[model samples]
Target: MTAADRSARLRGLIAPGLAALVCLAILVGLGVWQLARKGEKEALIARIIERSHAEPPAAPPPFADWDPKADEFRRVRAGGILLHDRETLVHGLAPGEPGRALQGYYVLTPLRREDGTTILINRGFVPTELKDPQSRAAGQVGGETSVTGMLRGSEVRTMFVPESDPARDAWFTREIPAIAAARGLTNVAPYLIEADATPNPGGWPRGGQLRVDLPNNHLQYAFTWFGIAACLVGVFSVFAWRRLHDPMEPGAA
Candidate 1:
């Protein structure tokens, strides 16, 4: 080809090649960002696993200052009586032996401690059929019980659904304050207690559903993002190559 023609073709290649390079760079940046997020998620999972497996920490002082960062998932021991009269049923579904069965509501009762404050206790899982207040009241094991469990934050309200109305004993969502008001509890702690794997006599609501499994699929997600970025790079490379070598090709021109 003539020098003038070659020069013109080279100039024509510059803009499209540069544009593809920019797109490829942006994709690579996004891939790197996703990889970083994956690393963060893995680290968080590790922290959760370590915390869950570690021996329960000593019980904090009653009404003592509780900080989420310092005390979340910390093992605590407390002696309190199960206020069965005020047990609030938290709706849940569990996988059963036979097809998907609605595992009854979580038995969340207030535990009145020696220090005059209340902590919501998730006694355990009960089948939906057995959620009658009368039956649960009848099944109450009297006397003060020593409870070991993990401390959990209260459930937050979502925008779509209306808040739970405790007066009517209706609970569509786990609004702690509303539930507390319905149950007539004062000075309720900001957190709930998930009972440990302790065997309740008579096999009632079984405790120990606090499976601390951390979902760490972030690495896979990061790889997927990176793969997309790699594909983008491949596409960009081909685009650049075509622009540089065959700028005047029928369709390309």
Candidate 2:
């Protein structure tokens, strides 16, 4: 091709070429980020699994020494009395199998420890019908009792989740501060204890339903981003090839 024709073709490609370069860089960056997330998720899952299977400490650590990040998921024993009057039901959906989900609410009750400190205990799942304390009075263990459970941190609600209604005693998450305040509890711990699979007297509020099922789809996300980037490269290459091969416009050169 003549010099003028070649120059015109180069000018036509400048914007698209620049755009392709910038887009490719962004896509590659996203793919790299997803890969980093994958590694982080794997490590977190390993630590959680290890804590779940380890032997529980003889008793829960002192309230002064409590740290959610360091202490979460640690199995612990606590001797206390169940304050069933202040129980809260948090909305939840537990998986029954691979795809089936069982709609229910987790029963959270404050346990009054021997030292007078209180900690919220997620006694576990109960059907909607049994959510009312009166409906399951037989299961409520009054007076002093000892509980073995998994320590857990406060749960943050999802973006679209509705806020808890204290007036109606409806909760969407295990918000420690809110529940403690609403229940008029004092000297409450920042963390909660998910009671082990210990059966209640009436077999209503089943315990030991804790599941640490973290979604590890970061690898898939990384692949998707990488695949898009590859497709973009192929498309840009084909466009460049076509432009180069197309006959130059009729002109006096």
Candidate 3:
């Protein structure tokens, strides 16, 4: 091809080449971001496992010092009277002793601590039939008793999850502040406690059903993005080679 013709052909490829480069860069960046997230998730899983196995602390850190990122999943013991009158049920499901899936509601009661501050304690899951406190009144421990459980933060709701309805007493997730407000409570701790596997008297609200099996799919996502980027490079290389050699094929002017 003539010098001018070759220059024109090269110029035609500029926009497409630049676009491919930008797309590749974005894909690679996403892959790198996922890798970073994988690291953060790994560290989080390690912390959760360690805290789950550790002995319960004498008491949780003061409300003023509560940090979701640092204090979540901590095993703690707090002395208080479970205010069953103000208890609320949150919708949930748990594995039954027979290994069957059991639909239930988590019994969350406000525990009035000795300091007069109130904290929400997740007494644990009760079957759908035992949702009413009256149905399992015997399990409702009154007066003063120490609660031992893991310190947990408010749950993050997804866009698809419906909002909590206090009037209907329907709670899809454990939203601490919202629950406290709905129940007309103040000085409530920012976090909630998942009561340990301690058996209750009535064997109703089965405690210790908390599971920490967080799905770690960041690595898989990272690989997917990286694989796409690699395929893009290979495809682009083939396209570029074909474009460069098109005129050299059998077609002569």
Candidate 4:
């Protein structure tokens, strides 16, 4: 090709070439970000397992020093009188037997401590039929009791989650502030507790509902992003080669 033809072809590629490079940078950045997120998630899981296995403290941390990131998934023992009448059922789906998944609600009852402070304890799952407190009478043991389980932060509602109604007691998300306000609870803890697998009195709402369902798919996502970036490079390479080879082609751009 002549020098003028070469210059014209280079000029034609400038805009589209810059756009492709920008896209490539974004794709590569996403892959790197995902790798970083994978590391964060791994560190979090390891921290949780280690803390969970350790002997739970005699009591949960004081409300004065509540840190969401540090306290997440930490196991702590709480002693209080389980106020069963103020129990809030959060709609959920859980594994019933081995392979069977059943629709149920997580029983979150306020436990009033001797200090007059209250904290929510997710007692565990019960089938749809036992939604009413009257149905699960035996499990409602009223008296001073203590529970050992993982301390959890308030859960955020997603797009798929339904609007929570306090009047109907229909909850889809574990919003601490909202629930406490609705139940007229005072001196409430900033976090809630998911009770361990220790069997309850009537075996109605099973305990140990703590499932670390953190999806570590960042590695897979990184690979996908990188794969897409590589494909884009190949496509741009071919397009450039064709345009430079055939400067007269109308579709080269």
For lDDT, the strongest prediction is 4
The sequence of per-residue lDDT tens digits that candidate 3 reaches over residues 175-203 is: 99989999999889899888999899888
RMSD of each: 3.9, 2.9, 2.7, 1.8
Task: List ranges where model 4 is wrong by over 4 Å.
Answer: 97-99, 251-253
Query: Model 4 misses residue 152 by how many Å?
Result: 0.5
lDDT (CA) for every model shown?
0.73, 0.86, 0.86, 0.89
Return whichever of 1 and 2 wins on TM-score. Answer: 2
> In TM-score terms, which candidate is top?
4
TM-scores for every predicted model: 0.77, 0.88, 0.91, 0.95
lDDT of 2 by residue, 1-253 (tens): 7878778887888999999999999999999999999998888788778987887775554466777767777888888899988888999876677888888899999998888889899998987777678888889997888888888888988899999998888899899999999999998988899998889989968888887788999999999999999999999998887776678543525
Off by over 4 Å in 1: 1-58, 61-65, 98-102, 156-174, 247-253
What clash pairs does model 3 have?
none
By TM-score, is 1 or 3 better? 3
- Scored against the true structure, residue 95 in model 2 reaches a CA lDDT of 60
* lDDT measured at residue 168 in model 3 versus the true structure, 0 to 100: 85
* Candidate 4 C-alpha RMSD relative to the actual structure: 1.8
- Model 4, residue 248: distance off in Å is 2.6
**127-239 per-residue lDDT for model 4 (tens digits):** 99999888889999778998999888899889999989988878998889899999999999999998999889899789987776668999999999999999999999999
Kindly indicate the candidate among 1 and 2 with the higher lDDT: 2
